[model samples]
Target: MLQDSFGRRFYYLRLSVTDVCNFRCSYCLPDGYQGKPDEAFLSASELEAAVRGFAQMGTQKIRLTGGEPGLRSDLPEIIYRLNRIDGINNIAVTTNGYKLPQRIQHWADAGLNHLNVSIDSLDSSTFHEITGHDRLAEVLEGLAKARELGLTVKVNAVLMKGVNDDLAAVLTWLKQTPVTLRFIEVMETSDQAVFFRQYHVRGDDIRQSLLSQGWQPVLRDVAAGPAQEFWHPDYAGRIGLIMPYSQDFCATCNRLRISSLGKLHLCLFAEQGIDIRPYLQTGVPTSELVQAVSEYVQGKKATHALQSHNSGAMANLSQIGG
Candidate 1:
C-alpha cells in the first residue's frame, strides 16, 4: 500500500488529464485560462502507465480531474483503458458539466461509476455571474441524464460570502434531488489571497446549522475523500462539507494527486510536485515506478499549513486538480 510517513494509507488518486478549462469562474480562472503553446500534458498512454503503477501499489479509486476534463476528446477512451487495469475498481470524473449532457453517455458506457459536477448556484443568473457561462439549464439536464444512466452523481458548490453563502435553495433541492450536495469552503491560493479574504466562508457554520436541523453525521469510509457527509431522514439527498481550514482536517487523508504533467502532489497545498513521468515512460518497470512513488510518499507532511495562511505552491486549484 502507498503509506505515508504519518501512517496514512492512500487508496485514492486524483489524476489530472488536462489543465485547460473553458469556464472562467470568478474565484478561479477569473482572467480565463492562459496556457503556453507547449503545454506538454500527459497523453492517454502515459496516463495508463502512471495509473497502472499506482494500481499495483494498491490504489483502487481513480478520480479523473482537470481544469475541465470534458475538453479532452479522448476522455471515454481514457476511462475505458483505466477500467481495464487490474486493481482499479472505481472511476470518477470531476467536471464543470460544460458538455456533459452531450458526452455523458459515452463516458458511462466506458465504465464510469461516479461523477462530480461543479454547480455554483441553482439560480441561472447567479450561476452565469459566477461561472461566466449561461449554460445552467444544459448542466442540469446533464445531471438528470447521468442519474438516468445510474451513475452516482454529486454536485459541488464553493461556499463564498455574498455569493453562494445562502444554502436555502440547495437544501430545498436536496429535499428532492437524490444526489449528494457538497459545499466546499473557498480555499486560499498563492494568487487568490485578495479574493479568498473577501469571499471565504466558514464551512463549520453550515455544519452546525445542519446538525441543529436534524442532519445526522455519517461516518466516513476509510477510502473516502475529505467531505464530511450528513444525512437527514426528511431529505432525499445528503449534504457534504469540505472544510480545509478546519483543525485536524488532514488526519484522515486517504488520497494523493497527480497533475496533468504526470507529477505527484503529496497534498493539494504541497510546495511542489514530484515529477514521476520518468518512471511512467515506456519500458520502465512498474515496480521501479512504485518504488519511486513510495519514496516520495515518505516526504508527505502530517498536515497542510493552510491555517497559517500559507497555501504552499498552489497558485490556484486548477494546477493540482483541487
Candidate 2:
C-alpha cells in the first residue's frame, strides 16, 4: 500500500483519462479552457499498466475522472482493461451524464458498478443555464437509462450562492427518485481569484435549507466519498452534503489524483505534482512505477491549505479532473 508520511494508506486513485469536457459549467470553467481537443489523453494500455501498478501496491478503489470521462471514446475499453487487473476492484466513473443513455449498457458490460453524474439543477432551463447546454432532457434520459441498467447512480449538484442554491426543488423531485442526491459546495479548485467568494456555499446552509423545506435525516453516513447524507420518509433515496470548504476531511483522505496529463497529485488543492506519463512511455518495470508512486506519496501533505482558498493557482477545475 502507498503509505504517506502522515500514516495514511492511499487506496483510492482518481485518474483523469482525458481533460476534455463537453459542458461548460460556470463554476467548473468560468474563463473557458481553450485546450485543443486532440490534446494528449492516456491510452487504454497505459491506463491498464498504471492501474496494475497501483493494484500491485494494494490500491483497490479507482474512480475514472476527466474534463468529462465520457469524452474518451475508448472509456469502455479502458474500464474492461482495468477490470482485468488482479488486485483492482470497485471501478467507477464521474461524468456529466450526457452520454450515459447510449453507453450505460456498454459501460455496465465492462464491469462498472458505480457512477457519479453531475446534475446541477432539476429544472431544465436552470440546468441549461448552469451547464451551458440545452441537453437537460438528454441528461435525464441518461440517468433513467442508468437506473434501468441497475447501476448505482449518484447525482452531484454543486451549490452556488445565487445560482443553484435552491435545493428545495431538487429535494422535492428526489422524493420519488432512486438516485442519491448530493449537493457539493462550489470549490475554488480553479485559479479564478473570486471563484470561492462568488460560488462557495456553506454545507450547513444547505442542510438547514433542506430541513426547513421538510427534508428528514437518515441517521447514517453514506460511504460516497466526503458527502454527509440525509433522507426523507417519502424518498427511498438519500441527500448528501459535500462541505469541502466549510470543513476539511483531510484526516480521512486516502486517495491520490492523476491528471489527464499523467501528473499525480496528492491533494486536489496542491499546485505541483510529479508527471508519470513519461515514465509510462519508457515502458519501465511496474515495480518502478510502484516505487515512484509510493515515494511521492511519502511526501504528501497531511491537509490542503485551503483556509484562505487563495493557494494553488492551478488550471480550471475541469482540466484538473474535478
List the candidates' TM-scores in order: 0.99, 0.92
Q: Model 1, range 159-257, lDDT digits (tens) per residue? A: 899998888899899999999989999999987999999999999999999999999999987668899999999999999999998989999999999
Sum up the clashes in candidate 1: 0
RMSD in Å for model 1: 0.8
- C-alpha local distance difference test of each model: 0.93, 0.80
Give the top-scoring candidate (TM-score). 1
Q: What lDDT is reached at residue 283 by model 1?
A: 94
Q: Tens digit of lDDT per residue, candidate 2, span 1-322?
A: 6788888777778999888887888887744557888977778877887888898887888899988888787999999999888977689999988767888888989989888889898888888898888887888888888888888899998888887886568766777887788888777654555767877778888788779867776553212366777777777778998777655568767788888878888788887768887657545888888889888888788787777665574657776676
Q: What is the lDDT of residue 129 in candidate 1?
A: 98
Give the RMSD in angstroms, all C-alphas superposed, for model 2.
Answer: 2.3
The list of candidate 2 runs beyond 4 A from truth reads: 208-224
